[model samples]
Target: MISKISSQRTRCKSWLLGGLFCAVACVAQSQAAGVTWSSQYQDRLFDSGGGVLDTQFSFEVGIFLPGFTPTASNVDLWESNWRTLDRAYDPTPEDPNDGDPEGWNVPEQFFVGYYQIEAGGYSSSPDADPLYAFPGGAQAYLWVYDSKSLDAPREWALLTDGITADNLADAWVVPDADAGSLEWYLEDLDVVIYGGGNDLQGPGGYTLDPVVFSLQTHSVAVPVPEPGSALLVGLTLGLAALLRRRGLSAARG
Candidate 1:
């Protein structure tokens, strides 16, 4: 009985210690980054749009790590943003007008996703039918293709944006030339993430937050914070650590 009890106690301690570290680290990191994770929300939630509560959407977004500070040598990381969400989705025409004067049409230049998904019952003449890409067509299914990268032209993550034209969108994610040689998101001299998706399925048709990245200090437990936010977090955490030590010592006595 004693052996069994001791084993159970050991497992309990292991779980408690592991859980605490993980929870603390995750919470701290999220706070430090202040990332706005991509998620489906009712258009009405933050809607300045008409009162429609459109809830369905597939979305992706990314923020490059602040200054590309951590693990700068990662080529794939350099090519892509620091964090991204390219959820798979496809738009199908289910309305009476398959794809014409009344669906969703934003110009090709505005999309954040690098690729596009053509909706069901697509029209050949995109110029005339500038509205819904698909009208009353078929059930939605996800399909993807690489909008860029001719060398490795494979289907990237599929998106749920409604029907769109096949032509590629104009590039907008230009590199900041002033960010020094280390910065690669160059608009003029560089490449990658050139264009984006536009005409969002949601009501507002645009992001509610600005894109930004937080620095990471992996060697230290505390995630690096934005310029003014770090000092307060550090002081509070230090005080908590001191109290924890005191409690542990008292328990031993």
Candidate 2:
């Protein structure tokens, strides 16, 4: 009778341990099934004396994959426009809508992640059609201000080489005479941008263009465990604890 009871206790413990492992594994597998691509931009304005201006803007975009469908609740987007600057420009006597002062040109920057997601459904532009780039769609694209030309007709160039889902974290050199560099990576669950080398000098100082900077990254999305899975884990733990206590009590008896 004593040997039989011991074997029963061992079987119970083994079953509970196996249940706990399976529950945890289910949660891990759910999270590893998909990838997410994210991007963000921060634009800072400065006065001619290098004083930081009151107006700054930032925007963010997130895209989850498996299928590039927005209806899948895979795309998240938001932007903060220049409200103060827009208000300041609104009250101007001439070109009231044009608040941007000369030489403080808002550098044009674009990330392909935004374009791809928007082109998937969020954008109304005819070019937004995914099929528009049929036959050979781009893996990624970037538009950066021309560092060589700070004059009129500010040129923005499109870069493609070395830019892809797998290579987003790499510092990509801007194809220009100056060969400026930029990087995109994930931080705190968001993509952050860091780069410089544009010739245009704003009030903030030279060598760095604070007018606009962007970062992008692609990473696997971490999924939350289902309520049922969580409950199972909790119950398993409770049962294991109870079994442990009962076994101890039986041994003492």
TM-score per prediction, in order, is 0.18, 0.23
lDDT of 1: 0.29
Predicted structure with the largest lDDT when compared to the true one? 2
Model 1 bad stretches (over 4 Å): 1-59, 69-81, 90-150, 153-193, 196-253
Which candidate tops TM-score?
2
Instruction: Put down candidate 2 lDDT per residue, 110-173, tens digits, no spaces.
Output: 1122121221222212223333221112222232222222323222222232434455453321
Off by over 4 Å in 2: 10-23, 26-56, 63-253
Worst 10 residues of 2 by lDDT: 78-87
How much does candidate 1 score in TM-score? Answer: 0.18
C-alpha lDDT score of every prediction, in listed order: 0.29, 0.30
